[model samples]
Target: MGSEKDVLVAAAVFLFALISHSEGIVGGREAAAHSRPYMASIQVPEGENMKHECGGFVIADQWVMTAVHCMPTGPNGRKVVLGVHSLSEAEETKQTFDILELHNHPDFRESNYDNDIALIKLDRPYTTSVAIRPVEFMRQGGTNPGNDAEVETAGWGSLDNLGSRPDKLQEVTVDVVISALCRRSDYFGSKFTANMICAQRVCPQPCDQLYKKQDTCDGDSGGPLLFNGTVVGITSNGGRKCGQLKKPGIYTIISHYTRWIDGILGLQPDPTPEHSD
Candidate 1:
């Protein structure tokens, strides 16, 4: 609370970046049936029905990784659907569970969209199958993604900004842009932080302006950004619209919070030396 203008600016930023209500997966193709076993559809209780709110991915036996902005605070009955392809069809491969705990990053700042990661513990461990499994995520000491690395993100979000939520899963690949470019005065600028990764769906060589763009949106929040079969980031937020070249999709770098995740998962390393002197 510095000044009245400052407060207004902060509120505007929060509203503009509050994309949890947008649909997702612009300029993407429908994924194959049961192809993405680790994909999770986060649902919240709406009236008497559960509504799809965000996307997530299974990281461990009972842990689902997503963005903090995707989860609801307090002890609510949240549902997760895994190993699903079509939302309209009742597939035999789908696995459902209730969330047991919500672990949002303690440093998360909604006003600035910082540290937007979260880990949700399910009521029970998922049953392993060919169509249901966990995805590996970047841990501490892991290498950062290379410049222009192609990453994949999928969800049942909208196909455009018109709020058309898809009934099936959709996927798109975007190139990782350098932080320096995203931090430019015209781009995200100072609002971009080191803990964030910016990715954009580039047009192919000799492409046209209307060639169609790709990106994550609305219901896609909290989904996995996979590079080389491992999740390196979580879908955080973006600009006013989806699939815009200037407004690249931003993600929460997972490696930066591996220690916190380990503690929550009960995998923290022992402080004592392995061998006594």
Candidate 2:
């Protein structure tokens, strides 16, 4: 076994490699246009360019939820694009909004990525329609769907480990890894917290070697982890290599922070309503 320092070094290396390689979904297929209406692409100004830094989902008329790490310090001319499938081409249904306010979890820390969630207030509200809609969050007291649950994650991140960011949105099915099993992994181990959720691809026979090949990559950070048609988690991070066997992607468990989220949105946590696709 490696010493704690060695483990930390390995973890740091893993994070750095993933961050440098790609920023999108790996092993996911192209999604149907406007299939995920709430999907939002968070863009940050980088010098003279506006780069897509992370993904998010509209939770309300003028609010978006994403990972706190996506904007560690604060928003910098950050804007969100919604109702679009392709990033390069403009769709008539697409709408862009400037960020008015940014609210990160008070306990968020770069170290260990605790409470890695944030909410952004849009400069204006979007007109709800078939192509632009908000997603419902997992209501309070909602049970964790369990390990066997098949969840869908969507993003415009990379399609592989080569750092190739996709122009079209991607969606993939992932299995929820039981917290206990997830906590036992060498990559995350005890670092797993209640605020975090783990997910990975389901493997067939000889699972060990086949477990890899599907995951959220670098550019996917702050995307939605959907279960039962509801937003259950927010993409946070993953292991060094995209979809590395035994290493699962981590997400900010949205249900665990209902109070904080409600506070930020200035609304009470109401029971989740039945939503139509």
Candidate 3:
């Protein structure tokens, strides 16, 4: 029992780390309400209070996709809240559901966050509305949203490095960084795999002029990285600081894991392996 408790505690911390950023959003702005309808908040009980651990996205009526690292180890109260902009106040658009099941990828590596994707089965199907829509996934054979492409990311993560959780959701525009450049960074150093993609917050000015880093922090983990309004990546990991120079945020490329996801969703998995650009 003691060992089991220890494991649970460790798992809790890992989940927290995966979702919570000590250094918060570096260059993010408050998002408009209902602008990101597919956003889902994964919440877990922490003593007397419930905390948002990670961000996810609705894919189907009853399915959510998130990082495998955010999976709860023990049943200490877990649920997903959708269609809400504010975490503190109740809104008519808000819909909460208990998690019926969690399916982590079979090859997910905890040590390195390889294959860091998972599917969440909600207890009931969510009613579709303008404020509660599912996000489209990158289709098979779709062109990769290449390096330097601007993408949108949203979450209710911390506002700064001191760890101040936000009441309202925030958003930032980031650019996809070349994989080779990302792999060469001092922090990641060849750890990137085929399943991973790297992105960096768009600099306010060109690097040659002025550099202002923007990125997703702790609470943004498992959130969708949107390209052309479709989910291209899921937040995985980043540097110790939220927005460090050259330390691009890592994400689980959705296209690479479509087979695993399709298997869980009862859809046909594509036989051909996706090629990265």
- TM match of model 2 to true structure: 0.84
Residue lDDT tens for model 2, 253-272: 88777777777778875555
lDDT by residue (1-277, candidate 1, tens digit) is 4999999999988886644323238877778777889999998888998778899999999999888887647437789988888887889888889888889988888875788989989999889888889989987677868889999999888788888888888888889988898899777887888889999886778998656688888899999899998999999888889887788999988887877788899997544322110
Off by over 4 Å in 2: 1-24, 46-49, 206-212, 269-277
Task: Write down the worst ten-residue block by lDDT for model 3.
Answer: 18-27
TM-score each candidate. 0.85, 0.84, 0.85
Query: Residue 236 deviation, candidate 1, in Å?
Result: 0.4
| CA-lDDT, candidates in order | 0.84, 0.83, 0.82
Which digits, one per residue and each the tens of the lDDT, describe model 3 over residues 123-199?
99998988899989886677668979998888988776668788888888889888888777475876787778888
Give candidate 3's error at residue 137 in angstroms. Answer: 0.8
TM-score of 3: 0.85
